[model samples]
Target chain A: MEHEEAKKTTFWANIGNFFKKIGSKISEKAAKKAGSSNKTQMLEWKKDGWKATVCLAPALIILAVFTFYPILNTFLVSFFPDYNYVTDEFGSFGFDSYALVLQDATFWRAMGNTALMVIVSVPLSILIALIITVLLNSIKKLQGFFQIIFFLPYVTNGIAFGLVFATIFSPMDYGLVNTLLNAVGISSVGWTGTTNIPYWAGLFVITVYAIWNGLAFKILVFLSGIQGIDKQYYQAAQVDATPRWRVFTKITVPLLSPMILYITITSMMGAFKSYSSVVSLFGESMGNGQNETFITAVGYIYKYFNRVVHDNISWVLSRASAAAVILFLFILAITGIQMWANKKKVHY
Target chain B: MEKELYFASDEQAKKYERIRKVRLFFVYFFLTICALFTLIPFYWMLATSFKTAEEVQRIPATFIPLQPTFQNYINVFSGENAILLRYIGNTVLVGILTTIFEVIITILASFAFSRLEFKGRDVIFALLLTTMMVPGEMMIMTNFTTIARLGWLDTYQALVIPFVASVFYIFFLRQNFKQIPDELYYAAKVDGNSDFKYLWKVMLPIARPSIITITILAMIGSWNAYLWPRSVCVEADMKLVTDGLMYLFQNEVGGTSDHQIMAATTVVSLPLLIAFACFKKHIMRGVARSGIKG
Candidate 1:
């Protein structure tokens, strides 16, 4: 019996050796190509330069025409005092557009509304996501099931979902929220229509929609971040009989800081650019008359770009460019500040 | 003889086990409630889509449709709403083309940045990365003007070309590519294999996961794109799904009814929902990988 077992082991070992020989031969070829001599390595490096340029050309050309040129043009156009859209002429160079945008009351309101959205929605979404992620991590089964259900909103078209949200918050008594409110003997609230709904109520609906939409990504990230934490940490905590809240604050939060920072910056930037969700809620006009209360920064920029001023199209163009530049600068400043503040805080 | 485990014999251990069971129950309860909140809008969308106009307008809205009908869906796909089906075709065509070009461009760019060493490579990469910080909204006005100048507006090129090369995607794929050992590239070279050949045979196969992730993301992004498509595709024939639905809503044919609007939404959203259901694991991994790496 011992002799038979030795024969079988030798057969398996022979197969492994055969595969090992092939692997070593391949690595030997690799090492040769890598070159042992300094002169040959220099020659290869020179060849790589041409290869890199050839490979990068297609993407670089497209990006230059569409991305890089457009960015430069936006900045240049913002500085043009009298830029003609139809004829493509720059009459003069000045900061007239910037001054007009900064001094405009509507611009300030838009900025305030954008700020409110980022402030309210980002933290709320993160907190809820963190709690849900913790709860999800504690469970051993049905985790994947719950994750799919939660992530449904993330995959669905945001605008279509926003439309569904609009229906639920519809001003009529038959709307979902109103119907639920009525069950508790509360009166129907005009949650959307600009006619009677308070500006705050409209903002409230937008905020809720944003937070709900934002939750899926944050939860996914936080869940992964939580799962990535060493299991031994939790085991050790349990051995010490650590309280649940204590473990969460002391262990989870500190470890998950990098993800927290990422979610905060990205969501805040997203909130600043909130347009389609607001459009879904308020429709094309966003709000009635000249005082569009619910307009966001990007929405404000879109409004100016599309706004027809007849013969003064140049003024509108300049203003739109200025608004775009302001939004860009604002994002840059905020991201810079966020990175600086969190540099020391993020665990990674 | 069997040995008794010390904790297994204690009354305190039993008490702890009971508490743990109760805690587990609460965890499930809280998760279920949150899951309902997360899922209710989708449920409402589906339920409303099937309900009668009167049912949708009924006071104390029905949790489930009392009289579900396919009439709304039928209306959406036939008659005045038949245009929506054409719009879906436009979106799918655009989506597929965008994915093809995007994946190719991203792979080439990422491969160059990852595997090839050249002078000013880091500088060029940094310049590319900076473009990501420039929001799409800022670029749209200028891109619109550029497209109009080139006479590409209202065409597939306008929708597909500008977005074909994404810096974010290139960055993602490059990170994946960099993980591949230098020895593989060297070995391929020793065999007299061309860079493109090696990329096709080895690097691509090894980095298939990231490529798949990029393809899925790009496809979804193309489908969900609204503002840019809405801006360029003004012609009725050129309208994509989101733009078409918005146009219909604004025009108010069957759009006035909540049920009909819900039906349109359900139709628009169904493809993605089905895609997600079939490839949930891949989609989740892609999203999680991107998030964690970022």
Candidate 2:
């Protein structure tokens, strides 16, 4: 506990020192600009700082325990291959945990499934959203009604909805999806087959539900975005008799590109972290035992190391942390790349 | 020339009106179909909850139940396996506690960030923003360990404590608090109010909508939380409402209880649906704000 406390203080001090250096420079500039009052400002700040600390204490303590310490400790634990998590002991530090994760085929499959979900779902959802938003933009009647209908799923429980989707595609002849397919002269297909769910079938089911869930938010964004666009743009198109398709392609698409980009990044990140959707569609095993085909990277962590299994949890826990760290870094790089590309974006 | 111009312009206007009506008809057509895509499943979930087992199994699935009954709902609540209320109680307890604690901490932290002149506040806030980039996956494994070590597993604290301090809410609430105008703080001081007193009496009331938004989001988050609770609160009794569905899934006999399962899902889903119906504006804006903020 003392060691943990020491590390926590040092982390805080580093944060303090890093800012204090730059803060001093900025304050010095202000001091020169506002000479006499700057002294009083300093005195006032001295009084305010302690009060701020007192107010911030409860939050700071909770954040340190739950957020900060865990991030640092997880990274540290990943490197300590021989780390006995239960006893909190480690003989030496190594990368064996990472090696184990990289060598495992399940991890690779998890990554593959995750990549496929992101690649397929994000762009499709965005394109479909943009199309709907544009179409909704052209009309005035029931647009609010449509927005509310689509947005319903956004607040509802995802697991419950995933189960709903599971039933819709329940593979039974009486299932809604299968029944519809039969009406269209197609044979019944089991999208979420219990005994023998095909990999592609499972992936297809997950992506469909994901895309459907995604529409609510994307449509909300574009509908709201369309309202903010100056009416003059549409008026200009109207006066020029610009083709509807051309106006949609030119004005609407370009105007909503930033939101599209943000949604793309967030959707991909959300897809990467997906766990329940897969669990909801397939059973808890993600698939039948050896045929377990649908585990995303996050689900992989959840599946193997969800509990502290006494047998090999020490070694396996490190591996789970290693897998999580890789996922963390990949997501970090994704956010960093997007932020660097859009330098003004302050948060994801 | 004037007569010719009028005739041609009139013809063009008629053509435009014809095209406009066609497009509008298609718009309504497509939008209705899309709306039904979402609304149908919800309708099905609700409709199925009232379905009898035989009605559910009939060769042609009933669109609306002909033999609608409360038996499925009763079945969900009555059997020894009916932990639906227990799980819902657990979820509500956890959600209320987490939301209250998180909101208080957020108000305090946001107050400091927005109103006070703390030395490292900017950098600390900046650091918090960067934490947003760090995937939540990183926290789960280690948090699992931390909670395990503390023997908090299967406990409400395991569910509530880890999630109580949120950087996003602090940032969100601070933005609203900053708009409260610094002059109020000065005026409060002149009136002999302490900083905390000023915040409590002045700042919070003004930031009420933002507070409500954060509160709804936090509650919804707790209500929908599956993975975290599934990990930490593994015991059957401590499971969340979402888990109640999972429990129904695992213990389902012959998987033929689609009607009862749907009933369970409907009950599991009702609180949020009702909450949304009540606070639609705050919920929608909160979602929009979460996306748009930084």
lDDT of 2 by residue, A1-348 (tens): 111111122122134454666678678857776765667767888999889988899888988888898899889988988777778886588999898899989899999999999899878988888888888876777777777888898877888888888877777776777777888899877688455666777778888898887788878877787777887777777667688789887887777666665666667777777778888888777765456688889888776576454234566777778888998888768755765665464222
lDDT string, candidate 1, B50-153, tens digits = 99988988888898999889999999999688899999999999999999999998999999999887766666876776676677767887887788778886
- For candidate 2, the clash count comes to 0
Q: lDDT of each model, Cα atoms only?
A: 0.80, 0.77
The per-model DockQ list reads: 0.42, 0.46
Q: Which candidate is the best by DockQ?
A: 2
What residue pairs clash in candidate 1, if any at all? none
Write one digit per residue (lDDT tens) for candidate 2, span B17-54: 68768978988998888888889879888887798888
Model 1 in CAPRI terms: which quality?
Answer: acceptable
Supply the global lDDT for candidate 1: 0.80
* Model 1 chain A worst lDDT window (10 residues): A1-10
Error of 2 at B183 (Å): 3.0
- After superposition of all CA atoms, the RMSD between model 2 and the true structure is 5.7
| Residue-wise C-alpha lDDT for candidate 1, range A1-348, written one tens digit per residue | 111111112122123444565567567757876876567666878998898888888899999998999999889989996887657898899999999999999999999988998888878888999999999988879998998888888787867877888888888888899899999999988787545667888889988998888888888888988888987777777767789899999999999987787777777777888888887777766754346778899888988776622123446877888999889888879877866777667775
Tell me the deviation in Å of residue A299 in model 1.
Answer: 0.7
